[model samples]
Target: MKNNPHHPYHPIIYVRGFAATQSEIEAAVADPYMGFNIGSTKTRLAWTGQVKRFHFESPLVRLMGEHGYRDVFVDGNDLVAGDFADQPIPYQSIIVYRYYDEASNDFGSGETPPIEHFARGLNKLILRLQDKVCANKRNNVSPEDFRVHLVAHSMGGLVCRAFLQNKGLGTEKARAAVDKLFTYATPHNGIDMRIVRNVPGWLSFGDANNFNRERMANYLDLPKGDDVSIVKHFPPERVFNLIGTNSRDYSVLRGASSWAAGDASDGLVRIENATTHGPGADGRDVTSPRAFVHRSHSGHYGIVNSEEGYQNLTRFLFGKLRIDGILDIDNITFPAELDKYHEENRAVRASYQIESAVSVRKYPWQITRREIRENSAIFRTYDQLFPGQPGTKRPPDRSMSPHLFSVFLDPEKSCKASKSVSLLCDLKLLTPDYEVDGVLFLKRHYEGGVIYQRQILVEAIPDTNAAGGWRIKYGDQENNPGKATLVAESRPLGDGDPASGLVFSIPIQQKSRPGLHGALRVEVRPWS
Candidate 1:
């Protein structure tokens, strides 16, 4: 709405993540598309060791085919030169930051600049893009349509944040030019290892200060003692984060890095730190939309190169219809005979593993998480909602929890091209009970933490006329075999039905399991 009525398919600026070593930095700078052009052949061999062979081609190529966008690299030059040189740069184009060029053999004197300098360079890059793409000419798009989406990885995310947040790091015009920002495995809150995740006070040499919370705060101009999650300059909603949960695969530093970072990490940045601040500096409780992928930071199973990452990236930038699915938790039926323990502070703690696969003929799934691994498709319900708090003056609108995840349904990507958006998903419910006698009792795989998995179908009919224009439908796929949906009702906006809005209930009919027999809702909205 700010610019054209299009799905905000403005230019994209690729920002690659941190290069730990000089060799790594050089490798990062050497690529014209930074790592966007890179492709992976072996994308997670299936259970049978039979490789699924998901050739993504590359995000760069897909953008061209799926969305009419071109990369601004010709022959060997990073950009066009000399008065357009008989050929003008296209309006909807993609450009890599080439930020580490100074340190690469092909460009500068092999000296890497600090993050602040890289950030300032980003501002300059945006302005340059404005001049090239937005200026009036034959195929010119107006300055109003000049906004660019920032697709960044790792420390590159911080660079974008710095440009927007750190005072004087970038001009207001440059900042406004950034319409949407998407990051894959970006350490938004700052990196941590083992328990010593925050950068040490003494290790101030080299680029180590880059991830240091204090240093990052100083460079990003964050208020003293505040975490980097809090954002003030930019709208939190415009940002999207793709989190990598597979740690065993992130073999950087020969597994030392992964081991140190430990559980619930992409093997470097913990899941907690992988997203932007849930609440901004102003205490606004503004959280960015993010999706968890079963990928590493980088490599074959990396968040950048894999199908899941690319699917998320393309849909977010180009997808016309958006749907969000959530569970309307009415009741959590804890295992009976265990209620006596509830008299004390001890109670059953449950975590829900939500794994969804977009059912499309052309592509297997934009994203897929079948089972619950440590950092995988599992979205935990850590908040304790006990049976005791029922009639005790409950908070307003307390029935719904945060959305499980947002599924961007692209018309072009869909085979049906927007008849109805559907997601075939399975939710694994795990109850890791509290320590009975002082011995902690929650070991994974070997059997202690994990519990249940439920399969369901979530659907919504698109209507541009209604607010959010989504007539949602959901049901238990496994339980209700014949019916397309158990709940065939439409969630139309402005109706008095609690399910009318973006958030609609999914009645969990797993009565036999004696597990949490409650209904969940779907919260669908436009992300772009």
Candidate 2:
């Protein structure tokens, strides 16, 4: 047997359910206030049916199994049902769960446990999973090498946030192990399920007697209290969030009358709660959350089974396949409405309104030109500069000096022009292909501008570390006359010099190697 070096030692373990515990039922049934067995929450029963019928099918099992992982399905209600210590190593796993209950119109009665309490229980479950994986000698995966990505429907997202931000979760490394999290329709803020009228002290599932709106508010980490805000605490890089939106209505209250503004929802969870909160910072958060749209909510029960939901689940679990830095969309642009606004207000704004007479209006123009500066026989090599000699000038047919051109900025590196006046001169080179050369004009462009050239060289540098870049030295070009004269020109019609073109030729240099490439830099001089 052979294992790849990049392979992880510990398999991914999935945990399922906000399951029922015998103790809770025994306590609820024994209470003097209740006459009959209210039983477990309807949501749990619904989830149980869904998981048995679809989530544990051959397709899903085979999908995860092929990746060298074992699906460890634990009963959320049983608490100690699944094998906590006997899971496969170096495989992806799952931990499925559902809401505590479907609270009927009965306030101050038996209700599901508090979400934060459930979150604490989940932390314990994770620790146990880690302990089991560590015991296997074949498991070489460290805590850092492994990651747990969560795929939750409805209330699952809230549970995840509580786990990360809760003081009980301990240090950052523990939090980091959970690399990605996708919530189907988690309500970051409280949902408008109308619990106020039905269940008395509905939010007080953890502690019954002292349960009040204020105390429950503290447990839920509302904006009012000191409870840690998951959004504020967790960085965006570690989480992946998804949301489901639909027109279906499942609200038993007021017959779907104004269910969180009524227009968009997955029948229960609103679209507003599907993705992360607010007009967020202009960036992505891998850790905190991300969201995607779905046509249907799958009736809450069928969320994990439907085609759209499953595809999203798999993509969220696996890292997006990279093919030239694109995913789902080829390219995205700002709304056309915003673009129109900017177009209408293209003029530079003064501190106050500037006078129309004082401000100069601008127009756009295009220019093109061609020239033959050297004989084909003498100019055999590729390294040549255009507009090389003296008294050679190209008319300004186009010019847009006021327009700004900014450099590219990325996380890997940041760069700006070394000088204020960064110039980009595009020069075309003509060459003949060896295979069929009656006289094929192989045109190519080179860039050079007066800003801040790092080294004083005769040739131009490349923009990226791709193919086709040349840097000519002072002695590289042939100086002997009767061969070819290096000529450069420009054509700016409206925003640039018109009739601007360049031509130059150099003697072909024979080399033992197949290809020749080098670099050069121009000296930086302060602008006057």
**Index of the highest-TM-score prediction:** 1
The positional error of residue 509 in candidate 1, measured at the CA in angstroms, is 5.1
Q: Model 1: per-residue lDDT, tens digit, 1-528?
A: 254533377878888888767788777766667788887877446679886755767888878887789877676555632345445677778888888888776678777788889999999989888887655375446665668889999898999999988867999888887888888888888888776758775665548768888877888788656477766688886788898888899888799989998878888988888878544545667667778877888887788887788888877777766666555555555445333443454643544554444443345554644245555554544353333452243332453353566667765444375577677665666554434335444443334343446666776666676445665666666777423455444454334453335656666665643355556566666555
> What is candidate 2's TM-score against the reference?
0.44
lDDT of 1: 0.69
Cα shift from native, residue 448, model 1 (Å): 6.7
Candidate 2 ranges beyond 4 A from true positions: 1-59, 65-68, 73-90, 97-111, 169-173, 193-217, 220-222, 225-230, 249-261, 277-289, 296-302, 320-528
| Top model number, lDDT | 1
lDDT of 2 by residue, 458-510 (tens): 22222233121111122221243111122212112222321221112222222
- CA RMSD for every model? 4.3, 22.7
lDDT of each: 0.69, 0.34
Backbone clash count, each prediction separately: 11, 78
Q: Over the full model, what C-alpha lDDT does candidate 2 score relative to the true structure?
A: 0.34
